[model samples]
Target chain A: MTDPREAGFVGRRSDGSLIRRPLSPHLQVYDMAQMTSALSIMHRITGVIWSAGTLLLVWWLMAAATGEAAFAAVQWFLGSFLGLLLLFGLTAAGWYHTLAGIRHLMWDAGRGFDLPSVYATGRAVLIGTAVLTVLTWVLLLLFWN
Target chain B: MADGKTVHEAALRTPLGRVRGLGSAKSGTHHWWMQRVTSLALLPLTLWFVISLIGLAGASYAETLAFIGAPVNAVLLLALIAATFHHMAAGLQVVVEDYVRGELRRKGLILLIQGGSALMALASAFAVLRIALAS
Candidate 1:
């Protein structure tokens, strides 16, 4: 065995070659060649967000069921700046998930498998999510106030 | 048991049967089917939810309760709760399976997600029911 001093921390083979350390491939190694892969991963990530986001919905429903005072407390929190930020994040996540989910359904029907169609649909999902989110906020601002 | 195969396996298998039976997990197809079905249902349900919530924004508690208490709204809300939570549980289960390494921890998390989703779903539905029927 080679002296540990020559190798320092890294292990060395008998012939002076550095031993290969096992490492998991990480983000730095991955070359995402197309948008579909990124969008596909985002779909799952946003799904997780959407599921957690439903907690707000549950909290709102529970509050409403309780009474006015309880509901008002919830309303106050939801009307706060941080709460609005959460709402906006949820809004974006919801729309993105919806659009990406539709793309998944289209794939289930055996369409959009070709590379061109995949990229096109990926772009559509991104555009559609933005459009829907913007439209929702515009309507909210225009009418809700 | 000739050739260690069931008679029905050779006689009744179709192309669809082959595909369904060919996967390593042999179980993902059902999960996929359920996800798709719930997602399709959620498409309209979620839209209804967003629009209704928009209408209810800044509304008084009484007005919001009244809106939910309407019979149609209550029914649709119930449907949305069922579909959405079921969908959420299924989706989260897949994520847990993919990332969680330790066997016990993975199973624990899967159970947690399922149990939590069920609890929340029940709570949400009860809230809707209480409003629609009681007040």
Candidate 2:
């Protein structure tokens, strides 16, 4: 009961006592260049972003179903500067998550465990996401215009 | 003398596991499986959706509506809607479980994620249906 090791919380004692302990080194202290940590954290973050972005999808669909004017309003907004920015953000998130999911699938199959390839693939995911996003927008501008 | 020696049995559960009572919620495997399946399904569906959206971008309202009304587009859009939401819910649930502290907040957030995604999926499906069936 006296030892802090048995306590779950940082500043707590085993016998239901509390003590303030300094916070441990966190994100600021971590080396983000290490692909493993950075990519894992990015996966969760983009997943969260995409989760919130799902509402936009719903809004678009509902607007379309509601009426022409409703659909146009949504479209006009999406076609605006801020809207494109938002869409671009979502696109980046989607591409990042998709690439990361593929990387995870490889890991799940035990394919990319080697350190060199892990770092290589990590770099590839970042590069690939950027390439995909830009390529998509280029195609969109070309055809959709 | 050998029979008189006492034997100690090894504990099956770890100390933390026993304290937690339930080793796992047991739904994690299902969540993992579905996330993978939906992710795989989404790979192609998302491509199709993006391409279709780009194609319809500058078209008139009717053109866009007609695109969704097309049989193949309607079916794929419906699938995309369902899979995307399911995937989002599963992924977000993991994120919430990892970071959202407190029993009430965690459970409440998880419930909100599940319920909100399901509702959106259903609404999106109905919207696609209205577009597909109206014409």
Candidate 3:
């Protein structure tokens, strides 16, 4: 009689250990060779964050529509430290998503696909997002009274 | 006769014969096409939104509301809200697919995103209408 463990389905490695499948490809192996891929991924990331951030927008709108008391409650929430942190994060995500979207539009229009140009544009997107976010916050602080 | 039968012959065919021109399932193409279309529409709408917000800067709540209540502004605001939520739903679908590996979890996320976006879009439209229609 054939032993159950000797079936072809039950296998072992040369060293007498159970064999395992290789791991799936992940971020560690992600190639940074293309600007479009980077921007596309970043856009999705920002989109996800922005989706969640819409809760704040809804809160503000609903409060404003309800009454001054509700509005004040939202204002209080927005003025707190935690609120400021969330706002900063949302601002950064927005700037990054928008600038990267512009880059994507350019590529979609048949421009800036060369190797050197792609890398240069990717760097520009990163710097532009940072600059825009800083400028936005500065203007908000200086003018939003 | 059995020895002569090939694997192809063993396959079953229904009354809806091979000649019946049943096409591929193409429901997803509409979602893909609409997302791109809305993205293009939003390119201009978003720019207009930024400009409008800038012009309304430093204005009081009443002033801002009045500005948004103007005919052109009201129409544009509605369009922006609709397009934005549609685009957002599409984007969130991709994000859900990427992050949620389990079948049930992925379906749940998709349903949540779709339902949430639809509700938000309707609510925003109602709010805009209220502001626009207030006498």
Candidate 4:
């Protein structure tokens, strides 16, 4: 307890014992009126999902380049129930991550740091992802043979 | 300040000197900046790719080949692949660094991720070239 970390706020209790303290806006301590924390975590989760999604894309592209037979195998799997399920999840994660990324970029530019805008943008990302994922699937189904 | 790094009036070194190496990594922000840069590129590239993919849903092999053979599609596909692998590596590095407590494990995982991303990007780019040039 001789040293203090920058982010770890420590305090002395009434009993004179040292305890790791949390400053303001800590999730459990703070009011739940703002959903920003949940959205922030989801941004990371979807980003991870999108990262894995790149491998699937790579697989598809590799197969397409290989030959007709190779490509057919990939298409067959992709059209299957299991493959389609993964694709559906990827689509939703992709849309969520995409919207979250835009929100992050705005944050980088210092545009949406205000409390109201933060909540608004979080909800917008949720709704946008839902709408966009549905539209993408609809478009794909319309062309499905 | 790092943990257990106590500063006292009797200490010879200033606060800046005491915490010099414990502070920010010199190129930490560069990693952050690159993440942002690649993400910005991905924004439009992904949108285009998704739309093109949907449009190609029912396309025949020959049609798909012809589409990818187009200069614009080939180039964009390459960009998309490059950006994707680049972004993924950067993003994963952050996650691993944040969560993995073992110093050795973190470094090993990061090296693996970077190497794998480079290989995957090269593989995908090579595929695009083969398709674009062969046809």
Q: Kindly list the per-residue Cα lDDT of model 3 for residues A32-119, writing each as its tens digit.
A: 5655566767877897797788787667656656666876787678778998789889889977877777777787789998988988
- Candidate lDDT (C-alpha), each: 0.84, 0.84, 0.72, 0.83
Candidate achieving higher DockQ, 1 or 4: 4
Residue A72, model 3: lDDT of: 71
- Which of the numbered candidates is closest to the native, going by highest DockQ? 4
Q: RMSD for each model, in Å, please?
A: 9.9, 7.4, 8.6, 4.9
DockQ of all models, two decimals each: 0.27, 0.37, 0.19, 0.42
- The C-alpha TM-scores of every prediction are 0.81, 0.82, 0.73, 0.83
Model 3: per-residue Cα lDDT at residue A57: 65
The positional error of residue B53 in candidate 3, measured at the CA in angstroms, is 4.0
Every model's TM-score on chain B: 0.80, 0.82, 0.80, 0.82
- On a 0 to 1 DockQ scale, where is model 1? 0.27
Q: In candidate 1, which residue pairs get closer than 3 Å at backbone N, Cα or C atoms, i.e. clash?
A: none
Give per-residue CA lDDT, model 2, range B41-125, as digits (tens).
Answer: 9999999998888887788888888998899999999999989999989888877766565668878999998999999999999
